[model samples]
Structure formats: structure tokens, C-alpha cells
Target chain A: MAEPHLIYFADPMCSWCYGFSPVIAEIRRAYGRALPIKLILGGLRPGTTEPMSQKARDELAGHWTHVQEATGLPFNRAAIDGEGFLYDTDPGARAVVRVRREDPELALTYLGRLQAAFYGEGLDITRPEILADLAAEFGIDREAFLADLDSRDLKQETWGDYGTSQRAGVTGFPTLVAGPNQDGAYGVVTRGFAPGDQVLAVLNQWIEGAVAQH
Target chain B: MTAARRLPLLAALSLSALLAACATTPPPKPLSQGRGAWSFAPANRSESAKLAYGIPNSDDVGLMLLCAQPRVKIWMSQPAAAPPKKIALRSGKAHGVYPLAPEGEALLQATMPAADPVLDAFAASGELIADQTRLDARAANERAAIRAFRGACPAKTR
Candidate 1:
């Protein structure tokens, strides 16, 4: 029998996903391969150019506050002052795609760090220089990361994932789907930021049920 | 095999346009409450809706609509006494939700034509990291605002 797989559908730019990061890490540690993990990009706001409107910004800020209070995550408001522009996630996501291509391990590490920068430190991920600086801090080859930042390959990959997110009916970030692969597989799907314990329990129950089915 | 195959790429794409309540109509009635005092109205064309009963004790308020698409929710809010956010009803599960900011309203109304597509795309990606940042930033900002509010309003608003 094949070991069940865990597919995590998320975008690097999702707020709830950031809140769930620690929980996801814990799940990976516990279930390493009894259920392997797969990361899918949910593509939050793919190609936006205009800065966020004050109305939109204020509303969203309210959401951020609500989520933080619920999840106990640290958030920095001052970060907004730095960019003073509508934040975009594409650049940050592209960097992740590029890194994942060369080294999935490094990509995972970088993603965690990137999340911290955006959510914890409130650093803007939209700017190339900001992304490049982050890469340098990780001891990543700066020139290479910059080059790949706009690489056709990574762009295609990001688009591909965006397309995939669309197909899955995954309209939000922090969506989790577990089941048999596209080939009539069975798994689980946890859509947004629920408590991590709830997520783990759901996964555990799903795995147990699937095991019993066999 | 490349793990990318397992990434559900196509799924993300198809769902992108349907993510936001930015350009659509309001859902139906028979409302119920949601997270943090928010309420979800009946399902409409293809989604549900949420309305906050004013923020905590302040006149600031919010309204959200979630499409039948299941997870997609759009919200709009105003500071107790602002114009009901002027949003054009566009095709697709798109609906724009904004707070009552004079500056935000000007841009939202002025650039509606150009801004829609961009806003739609961002809503589509729904990247986890981006969500995290926005949520955290909002929280941080909110905490500060609340602190200031307490200092200013103390007994009444606090």
C-alpha cells in the first residue's frame, strides 16, 4: 500500500497561511512520510499594480487585526509606512518558485524566512531589491536569485500554480486538500485558518479512516 | 516525479477570478453570525454575506459577501457615518469591499476601470504569505489604533 500524501495548498502572500505556518511545520515534523507533504501556490492577487486604496487598506487592516488576535501571531504595522504602496505578492512568490526549482529544502527555508519578513517584520516583498536583500541574507547567490526573480521559467511556474489553484476551486489562501491524487485518491482539505490542532486532528482522522478502508 | 505535478496548478488558476466578492451582487438573507461578531446573510447568486454589528463599541463597521463558490468572501466597511461604499456591480464573483476612507473612495471610484483587473488578480492569487502579511499588518495597526482610541476616548469608546 502507498503511504498517504498531504497536500498543502497555500500562497506565500496569504495572512492566514502565515498564521498557520508554525502549525504546518509541526505537522511535517510529526508525520514526515506516513503522509508526505506537497505545497501548492494559491496565487493571492496575481498581477496587481495600483496601490491599495485607503478604504481597502483600512478594511484589510481590520482583518489583519482580527486574525492576529485570533491566532496569537505577531504583526508589525510600521511595515506599511515603509512601502506606502499597495503591496504585491507576485515577486515574493516568484522568488519562492525559483528557489524551489533549484533546492526544495532551501526553498522551504527561504519561504519560512520570507513569511517572517512579511508577517513578523512587516517588510514589503513587492520590491526586487527587498527580495534580493532577503536572498543575500540567506546566503543565496544574489546574482542568481535576481536573475531568476524575473526568469521566464519561474514566471511560467507561478502562472501554472495560479492556474492550478483556480482549477481546484481554491479561492482563498491557506486551503489544504488531502486525498488520493487526481487519480481517484482520498485525502483531506482544510481551507483556511482554523486552529492548527484542529487541522492536525482532521488530517489524523482522515489518514486513519483511509487506512481502515483498505 | 516532480512534486510540482502534485501542486494543483490548474486549480489555482480556475478559482482566481472567483475569489473576491469585489464585483458582484449581494447574497440572499436569513443571516447568521460569523467570526468576531460578523454575520453571514443568506446565500445569493452563488455566495453568502457577512455584516459586522459595528466594530466593538465604535460606529466603525464592516459588511462582507461570500460567494456560493464557498470560500470567497468580500467585505466593505465605513466609519459609522459614511456613504454606503459605491461599488459597481460587475460580472463574476467579484465584489469590492472598502472602509470609509475619503482617499480610498476617491481612488476606488476614479480608477474603477483600470483597478478592477488588478484587484481581481490580487484577490485571485490569495497567496498564503500575502494573506499572512496583510493579516499581521492589520492586526499590528489595529492594536495601535485601539491603544490610541483608548487613550483618547477612554470611558466612552473603550
Candidate 2:
């Protein structure tokens, strides 16, 4: 039988994706290698050189508050409150693509760190240097990582993931899909944010059901 | 049948089985995660003489430990749910499964003696997960709430 796997479509800059982090972590904690999760970065808001308007910043902050209230994850509202702040998501997405080439699973872990750096710590994750520093924490070569981060090919590949998300018809951040079952059918695990235990239960049930079928 | 004829037939059967084993739909589409987080308010208020502790992001505690004198009711509020018949809880090394019932949209409840060791294990454990819900039981305010609920509620029965 073909081995089963997970495809997680997310944007590192999305607040609800940050909220969904703990749930994915719980899945990793509970299942480890028994199930493998592949990360596909959805380009939430890419290639914007224009600074956010006051109204846009206000609207984004409001969404962050809702995410925080729902998931108990931290949010530094002031992260983008400063004047002339740009919210380009390209760098963060490229960084994950870069690291994914070296250590596929580490890509997911690095994505989590980038989310924490962006949302929880209020770090400007839109910068290549900042993204490189986060990668270095995982023992990646800082200079090599930065060089790759600046490459045109990685930029195209990151955008490719966005295309994949669109083709998959994912209209939201934090869309998790399960399957390629024996019938090769895929199932939506959760389109939006869900708590850790709930996700863990669903995963456990999937395993149990597969075993029952045998 | 002759050995050569039988050999060819066996080989054909094996190849077909191998092909079936590797068979998959040429292209797989996304299956949606059909469920979202359940609603909480109704579950929070389901019990009479109810006292609750916060579980993050929710002002309403759908998962409750209700005070009913000598027994504490472990009520999980699940609206329009196909919940497990028993709640499997884990907080660190301490774990147990308690039976459950559906009172309405929310599952009715499962009660244990107030002094049940599992309750202490649940309280002392770092994080509490009841069935599919993870609970924040580590906060000081919540701990105080637990103590207060226990004090005001003497278990009506063991």
C-alpha cells in the first residue's frame, strides 16, 4: 500500500496559522514519525512594497486579537504598528523553501520558529537577515542560508508553493489535509484553527480506522 | 495442469496483486477538515450550582468540573457532537477514562468522588486534556477557582 502523509498549507505571516501552531506541535508530539506532515507555505500577502495604511494596520491588529483570544498564543500588536511598516511575506516563505531543501522536516520546525519570531516576539520577519538568524538557530550555515534566501530560484519556488495552495483551492491560512488513502482519496482535517487535543484525537482515530480496515 | 502452465498463471496473479498494491488515483484532491471548534456557552451553563475554570480563548468553559456535593461532575460541553462514550484524560503521567452521557447538545456528565485520586492528578498535572480538548489548568487564578469550588461544594455522595 502507498504510505500516507499530511499536507499542511500555511503562511508564516498569518496570525491564525500562528494560532494553529500548537495543534501541529501536538500532532508531532503524539505521532512523531508514525505520520509525516509536509509543509506547503501559502503566500498570504506577497510582493507588496507599499507601506500598510493606518486602516489596514488596524484591521490586521483586530484579526490578531481574535486569533489570540481563540488560541492563547502571544501577539505583539505593536509589531506592525510603527509607521512605514511593510508586510511583505516573500522573505519568510522563501526562508522555509530554502531550509526545506536541506532538511524537509526541519522546514516545518523552522516555520514554527518564524511564526513565533513574527507574531509572538514581534520580530520583523520580512527581512532576509532576520530570517537567516532564525535559520542559524537550527545550526544552518548563516551565510549559505542568506545567499539562498536572496536567490531568484528560491523566490520562484516559494511562489510555486503559493500556486499549489491556490490549485488545491485553499482559501485560508492553516488548512491541513490528510490522506491519499488506499483509494488515493484525500480528506480535510481542518480548514481553520483547531486545538491540539482535538487534532490529536482526529489523528489517532485515523490510525485506528486504518488498522480496523486491515 | 502442467507445471509450466501453472507457473505462468501464478506469475500473472502475483503481478496483478503487486499492481493493485501500488494502485492509487492518478490525482488526489484535497479533502476538507469538516469540523471546527465547538461552541462553549451552553456547555458552561449546563450544570446547576456551576463553578468553572477558564480554558483559554473562551469566556465559557464547555469542559467543566461541576460541584454536586460529594461528587464532582466532569461535564464536557459538546454541541451537535458524536463524542466518545468515555472521556480519556491525560495530564503528564496521570490518566484515566471516565464514562459520559449526552444530556442535550452537550454531553450530560461523568461524576467521580470529590476525593478521587484522578482529580488531584488532573489538578496537579501541568496541562489537562479531556478527550479531544486541551485545558489550561496551570494558571494561579484557575487553581484558586478549583480550591474555591471544592470548598463550597462538599461531595453529596462518594
Candidate 3:
């Protein structure tokens, strides 16, 4: 019998994932020791050149509204509607990867804080400088964070994270997959944003099943 | 400039601080609506399928389908009491009414045509909207989803 692991596929710019942050935190709290969890970046909008159009912004605002209504998460409408705001998510995704490499434990915290900084405070998370600042606020060294952010290798590594997510059959942000072990075949546990309790219930079942099988 | 004026000013400051604190705190647990729980089983070896069953943030009851194998299949769960008379899928240049079939207890599934042009169009689109009688839902991050589906299940060469 192999140890089962949980993988979470998410994007920082994804609003639903932002709503699921608190729930994910709770999962980590309860099961962090029992199950080794891996976080992979699902690139939502990478290499997007054009600035967000009004129609796109309006549609995204509607999504934010829905998430807020369902989860009570706060969102900054002004930042979303601000002029010249590009919706590219690659920079933020790459920042998470960088954090994951530097401090594995801080990676999730950085992701949560980044979500809060973007959706909650209306900060532009797509900019490398802004991301570096956020990293510093999370106790990461600012200069080193910037240097790593600009490294060609890190960019490729970020793309690699996206590739891993795609290979794992993750189509949406905040997807959770369960596997027999860290290196085994994975089955989708939950896709899209789910509440903490619902996720835990399903995970608990999986844990019990694994125990029974062994 | 008297004590009374100072008292009101201090009270206003305290209220502002309290509101700011409230704004920063994380939200409470969401009300239980029986949304967001799913189970998974391996698909047939020849064809790969990833099914997500639960209430998505947007719809009442939702199931997301990603299939790769003979061709590409992307299904967004719809709210139909009975199977709809017509089903249509439209993106940027890829627009067509697809043949619908029931998937399990709920969900109507459709496979995109295997032609290169159709697959290409679907892959390039930013969003895909599926429509049926009294139900409509859009899939975001569509390009990534299409790419993942294609990578996992490639079209078989005829």
C-alpha cells in the first residue's frame, strides 16, 4: 500500500479559488500531517497581450459578485474596473512557484495573501514588482524575490507547473485530486471551488477507503 | 475646540478602525447548500474521461466533463427536467448544434467534431457557452481546458 496524496490545482487570479482560500486553509490545518498536499499552478490567462475590455470586466465582475454572494468573500470592484488593467495571470502564478521553491511552507501563505491583496485590496497582482512586494510582506526577501522573478529558469519552471497541471487533467482552478500515492494515478476529488466541509467530507471518505484497502 | 468636540472625533476614529478591522477579517463559513462534493472513477482505457459532479459556484446542479480519445468532448451541466429538444455550443468561430446524449443520472454530453478546423477553433476560444432549453452556462479558462483535454486524449487518426 502506498501513501495517498492530494494535489490542488489553482490560479491566483481566479476569483473562485480566492473564495476557496479559507476552506483550503482549514483542510491544510486538519490533514496537513496525514496527507502530503501539492499545489500546482493552473495558468488561467498566460501571455495575454490585450488589456481587459469593458465587456470582459463586466462579466468577471458578475463572477466576483456570484462568489461573494455564495462565500461572502470580499472583492475590490474598483481595481477590477480600473483602466488599462490587464487580466494576465502568469506573473502571479510564477511568483507562487518561486515561493514554493524557496520556502515550501510559505508557498500556501503567499498564495492566500496574494489573493487577499488582489481581490480584497485591489492591488495589481499581475505585475512582477507588486508580486515581489507582496512576497516581502509575507517575510520573503524582496531583492532576492525580484531576482528570481526575472530569472529565465523560473519562468520556464512556472510553465512547467502549468504543464504538470494540464497533464494531471485539471481544467479549473482549485481542483483537488486524490491518488493512491504521490507518484500514483490520481482521481479527481473535487473540481472548481468547493466549500471546506464538503471537501473534507469527501477527503475523509478517501482516507478511510485507503485505510480499509491497506 | 472643547472636550465635546474631541469626544465625537475620537468616537468617529474608533468606529472607522472597527469597520476597517471587520473588512480585513476572513468571511465566515459558507451556508450549507449541498454544493461542492464530487466522486470520481477511472474512465475506459481507450477513452479518457474526467467527470466533476457537484453544484458549481454558478449553477444549481452541475457536472463538468473533460474527455479525450477518439475526439474532444466538453460538457457543462444544464438544468433540464427532461432532455432538451435542441443543444447548441458556440465560441469564437466554432459554432454548431451538437447531438446530445444523457450522461449517467444527470448531465447532457456532446463531443466536438474531430475535424482540425473545429478543434482548432474550439481550442483558441477564450470562453465556451453551452445552451439548451431554460439552461445556459459558460466555461471560463477554456483554452487551458481544451489544451488539457487534447493532451490527455488526442484525436485518433482515421
Candidate 4:
């Protein structure tokens, strides 16, 4: 029997997913080897044309507040309040995809750095230059990363990841689904932000169930 | 106390009160509940819909529509309750109860018929009415969002 796969559908720009980062780290420590984890972008606010409205700004600030209260994750209010900040998340998602393709090992680390840069430090991650700078910080080749980011193929793959999120019936970020493979039957362990211990318990249950089925 | 000492103490209290007030303020309503615009990406034929919509700022709740064979599956951020087996969905004169099913712990779904009339009715309706929640998907971009969804996962020919 093949080992079950745990797919994490999230966006680097999602505040809730940022809050769930510590929990994800704990899950990684507990089940990293036992269950292979796949990270896919959920494509939040991708392809957005208009600048975010003032109302939208207020709404997101409230969410950041809630996430900070719930998860104790630091958030910079200035990021959302910054002028002309369009919340298009495609650039950040594409950067993660590029890193995943080039250096799969650094993909998750790259995602964390992007989240920290955006939510914690209030850095605008919608720009390719910003993403490349962060990539350089992670020791990834900056120019090659930019080339992959602008490639037609990467755009298609990132869009494909959005479609994957839709087909997986994922409505929110930080969704964790466990299954046999990309094509095989999968079950959602949790959706939205959850504590590490709670997610681990569900993972253990699913692992036990998979074993029993075998 | 000296006026200088009282000034600092008063400033501290006022600042604390202001922070508390900001924290206690109710969250803003989701953009979907109002006349907010939504954008749709170009559809991908290999999978389901390549669209995204949510109540802005309510990070935990979102609505996703996927095209499956013979039916369009709708998923919401809200969890499914055991009762309310059926939900009445209406747009304009076309109204029906989409059978609600539990997709996962944090998601609920209602599968609508994929026939043209059903899809057209939903597309043409100014608002999607279900109980007290009304989703305004009648805007030009919202309609495009729906079109992209249907285009991605069209019904298979028999």
C-alpha cells in the first residue's frame, strides 16, 4: 500500500494561513516523514484588477485583529492601510510555485518567508522584485527565479493550482486534505485555521483509518 | 498629584480606552453581502471553476462553485448542519431547493442541475437568495465569474 499524502491548500498572502503557520510547523515536526505533505496555492484574490476599496480595507484589518487574538501571530496594520495596495495574490503564489519547481525543499520555507514579509513586516509582496528579494534572502538564485516567475508555463501551472483548489472543493485557505495520491480518493482533515494539536489528532485518526482499510 | 504627572496618567488611560473601543467594534460585513465587485480569472478546462469569491475580511468563510458532470457543486465556508436537509435557492422567477450535503468538517455544498436553463436562471437573477443570506452575483464581473465557472466544467454530452 502506498503512503497517504497530506495536501495543504493555502495562499502565502492569506492572513488566516499566516496565523496557522505555527500549527503547520508542529504538524511538519510530527508527521513530516510519516505522511508526505504537498503544498498548493489556493489563489486568494488572484487576477484582481481594481484597487481594494476602503470598506475592504476595514474588513481585512478586522480579520488581522481576530487572527492575532486567536493565534498570537503578529500582524502589521500598516500593510493593509498603505495607499494603493492592491491585494492581488498571484505574484506571491507564482513565486512559491517557482521555488517549488526549482527547489522543492525550500518551497515551504519560501512560503513562510513570504508570509512573514507580508503579515509580520508589512512588506508588499505583490511585486516581483519584492518576491525576488525574499527569494535571494533564502539563497535561491534571484535572476533565475524571476525568469520562472514571468514564464508562460508558471502562469498556467499557478492557474492550474487554483483549479485544483476548486476541484478539491476547497472554499477557504489553510485547508488540509489527506489522500493516497493526487488522483486517488482524499478526505479533508480540516479547513480554515486550526490549532496544531487538533490538526495532529485528526491526522492520526486518518492515518489509523487508512491503515485499517489496508 | 502635579498637573504634569496627571497629564501622563490621563493620556495613558485615554489611549487604553481608545484601543479597547477599536477592538470591540463589530467586524465589517462581507463584500458579497453588499454591492462589492468580484473578479474572475480565465477558466481552466482541466479541472473545475477557476474563480474565487468571498466576504472580504471574513477570512474563514468563502463561497466556491465547481462544475461537475450534470451538476454544479457549490461549497461554502460555513459548516453543514444535520438538519435543513434542503435549502431554497432563488434567482428571479427560477427557484429550487438544492440538496445540501456535507463536504467536510468546515464546508457545505449544494449541487444544482447543470442544464442551461438552471445555469441561465442563476446567471440572470439579480441576487442569490437563501434564507437571510443574499449573494449579489448579478454584477457584470460576477456574471463573468459564473460564466467562467460553467465554462471550466461544462456538462459532458451523453
Interface RMSD for all numbered candidates: 14.6, 14.8, 18.1, 21.2
Each candidate: fraction of true contacts kept?
A: 0.01, 0.08, 0.04, 0.05
| Stretches of model 3 off by over 4 angstroms after superposition | A181-183, A212-214, B1-55, B58-158
> Tens digit of lDDT per residue, candidate 4, span A90-163?
89999999989877657877888899999999888988999999999988899988888979999999988888
Q: Write the per-residue lDDT of candidate 3 for residues B1-158, one digit (tens) a residue.
A: 64323333433333222222232222122233323433233466543555444446522224454555555554544321123544575555667776764432223456665543444554565344456221122344334555555444455644
Off by over 4 Å in 4: A181-184, A208-214, B1-60, B63-158
> DockQ (Cα-based) per candidate?
0.04, 0.04, 0.04, 0.04
**In model 3, what lDDT does residue B31 have?**
31
Give stretches of model 1 more than 4 Å off.
A1-3, A181-183, A210-214, B1-158
| Candidate RMSDs in order | 15.2, 17.5, 17.2, 18.1
* Alpha-carbon shift of residue B56 in model 3 (angstroms): 3.2
User: Residue by residue across B7-81, what tens digits does model 4's lDDT show?
Assistant: 334333432222223322222112123222344545455454444456333253555566666776665443211
1 or 3: which has the higher TM-score?
3
> Where does the lowest 10-residue lDDT sum fall in candidate 2 chain A?
A205-214
Worst 10 residues of 1 chain A by lDDT: A205-214
lDDT of 2 by residue, B61-96 (tens): 346666665776776543211336676766667677
User: Stretches of candidate 2 above 4 Å error?
Assistant: B1-158
TM-score of each: 0.59, 0.59, 0.59, 0.60
